[model samples]
Target: MSRLIQDAYTLAKERYAGLGVDTDQALATLDQISLSLHCWQGDDVAGFENPDAELSGGIAATGNYSGKARNADELRRDLDLAYRLIPGTHRLNLHAIYAETGDQKIVRNELQPEHFASWIDWAKANHHGLDFNPTCFSHPLSASGFTLSSPDPAIRQFWIDHCIGCRQIGASFGRALDTPCVTNIWIPDGFKDTPADRAAPRRRLKESLDQILAVPIDRQYNLDAVESKLFGLGAESYTAGSHEFYLGYTASRNDVLLCLDAGHFHPTEMISDKISAALLFVPAVVLHISRPVRWDSDHVVTLTDEVQAILHEIIAGGNLDRVHIGLDFFDASINRIAAWVIGARNVMRAALLALLEPTDRLRSFETAGDYTARLAFQEELKGMPWAAVWDQFCVQQEVPIGIRFLDEVKQYETRELSKRA
Candidate 1:
């Protein structure tokens, strides 16, 4: 056996010993281990997968919204669809609103008490099996230009009111769903150019976060503060920037946690070690998994071999369980469903690789009391190409290749086009 395979065998033996399993059971367990079962959904997948398709497309296509009904169904069908796509065992990150203007901004006009209530009902019915995270508001109003720093209080209050309104909506959703509605706060609130005032904008964000947490809600919600490096307000200028700034800001606040985006960290710094360390402080409630190419961060769920190794090492060192995995992709060109399916596949492979580490090896590294273990682990992973591992595992499990999945999506698109014709 190769070193990696030997390591896997050793870990299996240890697990079997803990379970008091005989050699026969250990071998059987090893044989049954597959790589397609370890992934979870990120909210961005819904938006990225189908820009035109409402959240309902990812959830279910069976509901309707008539003109200004007081009781709107925010996500009943979508929630059902989300439930179907992800088994109850996995976490589902639901986007509250797609970041858009005019007709696309569904939350501004339609997400009323009745719609909120329907979401709550759907969540409560399905909570026993599935874990749900209702990411807080994301729309033009929620962005930097529209928040507390705005010259007009009405505009700022509109943002605040939206937060307050969403809290009420979230409370209903959580009550009906029986799961905590995670407050995902990602503000494109920084200056596009050199800020006329740097500290002021950050202070505004802090105030907003503090105010939101103070509101009375039924269940405990985590404020997942997303860190990005891109300086500025508009989507075009906002590049994924430094996470340390966001992490430092939220760490002091109660009920607040960091929502680490893998690609976001790639631009500012090498994230593996920094991320490992961050987990030591704040609880990471959610993860945005993607790869960064050049300066632009592509939401391709494709993992480089080095990244897979680092992620595995981080998990083996004990950060995996703290956060829910989100298969985040935001590419406009790719088919959204294909992105979700393919991204989920890559995430599963990453998880299996992480889980395959031997407990003793992990413990020994932890006991060493030095940070060098991260480096050593990276060295161990140096020779192993994750692409090869992914390919081999796909073949072994009889799962479709990424290219095949993409082609399937293309065919679906073609059929849809024909129907339109």
Candidate 2:
């Protein structure tokens, strides 16, 4: 067991013993925490803008590509900045330009496919971990932002070709880096205005995926199907208006896994328990960690009591092993640097708390529950208030603000270094 898990178990035992609970529940809970930590691994999609600069109104309002470089030299500078800004302990899910450019619908669309070779070379040379989402092209192809049942075969074919190319590039990159490339395939491929079109798109999407999976690739990849809210389409218009359609489809495919985005579940008002249960069957390879603010999802992590309780239950349920906890932030109206910091802190706090929870007791609880007994049972979480625990964990983790600043400084330094070199 990791030292973190061991320490958490000790703390839980000491605390629960004082509560007069001696049924071994506390020890079991601690063991669960240990198991979770043992299986812990995470990564996030890249291109997280800095929150401070974004909020300060530094970025362009048009949402054009002006901040980062498009060439090899520019990429090197950015990679160096990422290392300096993000702490060494934190692993990034570097978004391939394919996904970013596809999402932004840049006029040239030249950053991704055209530049894929160089990006892979850069990652291998620099030793940066990669997290790629190959199907971001579907976002624009969908007329309603998620309807895969479009009659336009031309548009569909375009996306299909793009996905195929992306997979080929990803496979090569993974082999070069000797790292498992996480292929997160999320589509805004649902219906927008009609419920009738929902089933067809989902079916077609599965067909499309089937074709891609048939392609020969050597890299060990996971098809992370991200479930998100129904946009452009009415809530009730889609398949039961939930993400289960996508999940069920991906689960049927070989070597494909689900990428659970915490914010995506917000629209359905599904709590952590529902998420835990839904994903228990399919291993979760990556997690997009963020807080949800009312209707606007993916807010900064605020260490709320509700959030802690939800996360604790999920960790106790045994899905943390396939986790790649990555930062996902988009604040159209705030400083980009501040946004990055907030997103990073959110991920850090959640991870630390997850590491602190007891594991043994949780497993026992899972087994101890008779259908009736378990239904009536309530979990006894022993610790300081969640906020206090969060604070303590942050202190323990020792994540410094300087780490966030490092990326910016590194960007400048890299630029100068390249200029001189």
Candidate 3:
């Protein structure tokens, strides 16, 4: 560890101690929380399913960043670089579109564990877990802006079969790694213009989801989740799987979780305010942390007030045990590895800051109806030496601390990323 970082952490530790916050405990808590790094970021959401396939489903990565992963090996290599810069280890989130089909024409419904054997081996070797997602876009069937909720039964059945296959893959990951893999289902089914009947699509969606979850899967190996979106590129008018739909679906079904994507809501909505309410009825919840500019841009995440509030709410509401935290964003505007490292580091930093908060005292003040002291003490904590403790954490984890970390990213970009054809 660096002596300078340790010395600064010592002073910061003493300062936090006066407020009854234990730096060691906070760091320990941060270490326990694993943020699943989204794999699409490294490749700008361009999966290897079809090298010539263009992005669809109202999704887009806005930059022609150099060295985007062209294959599974390159993606893993880039992820390796990202993990080196991040403190501690975390899980990887994968989409079904990234399956390795080799020269064979393996349809989504026909995908199997063998397609992801390399990923399983790599993750096992790296001591990381895996999460899976069903890709419901960029296919000919979904070009009409509907999949599971399509009026055509044949088209809807195809997606259902694909989702079923994805569940099996997710279970295989969990069985191999001995960690429950969360298989999430998110579809871009909606209308660009006002629909004559919104209820029909939603009803069809509910039926489709029921059919998808009808097959019994062991909870020990796989957990199911549903994600919702307010709107999308062409579907700016209506989204079938709205937040209310998934909330009601998950609440009614004891077996699945509701995934709350921070960027999937309206600009005025805060995911932090919804955690407690969701946890009250749903068995568990999953979070797709991201930054939304004026809309669902999927911008890179930073340690903003909303992010901090999300972490703080999870910690304060005692929802940590029931919430699965994962990052979901793709910014092709910067070094992909650097983007991954920055987002993951910011998440960890927010968690650390939340952990360092004196929640019990604040709660007691709230309980006693002392709102004045509660606000004052909360504001006072804003001046805490969080950066020093974070630097010390990076030192302990044997990663580059502060600006030093960017040097490695630059070096890798010059040596490796720039050489990509």
The TM-scores, one per candidate, come to 0.65, 0.64, 0.99
lDDT of model 3 at residue 287? Answer: 96
> By TM-score, is 1 or 2 better?
1
Better of 1 and 3 by TM-score: 3
Q: Identify the runs in model 1 with alpha carbons over 4 angstroms from their true place.
A: 1-88, 98-110, 116-146, 218-228, 232-245, 266-268, 306-310, 362-421
The best candidate by lDDT is: 3
Decide which is better by TM-score, 2 or 3: 3
Q: Write the per-residue lDDT of candidate 1 for residues 1-421, one digit (tens) a residue.
A: 2456445545555544453333333223333322121112222233421344343211211212121111123223322332333212344444444222333435443345453343344445654312233332244444444354454656555666556655565555445555555555554444444445555555665566566667766545323344444433243333222365567765665455676656554364555556667676776645566666654344566656645655664565666555555544444344444445656565566655554444465456668875587457646544433344444444444445436655554565465422321
Quantify all predictions' global Cα lDDT against the true fold. 0.46, 0.46, 0.93
Off by over 4 Å in 3: none
Residue pairs with colliding backbones in model 3 are none
Model 2: ten consecutive residues of lowest lDDT: 34-43
Model 2 residue 313 CA deviation (Å) reads: 4.7
Query: Best candidate per TM-score, number?
Result: 3
Looking at candidate 3, what is the lDDT of residue 116?
97
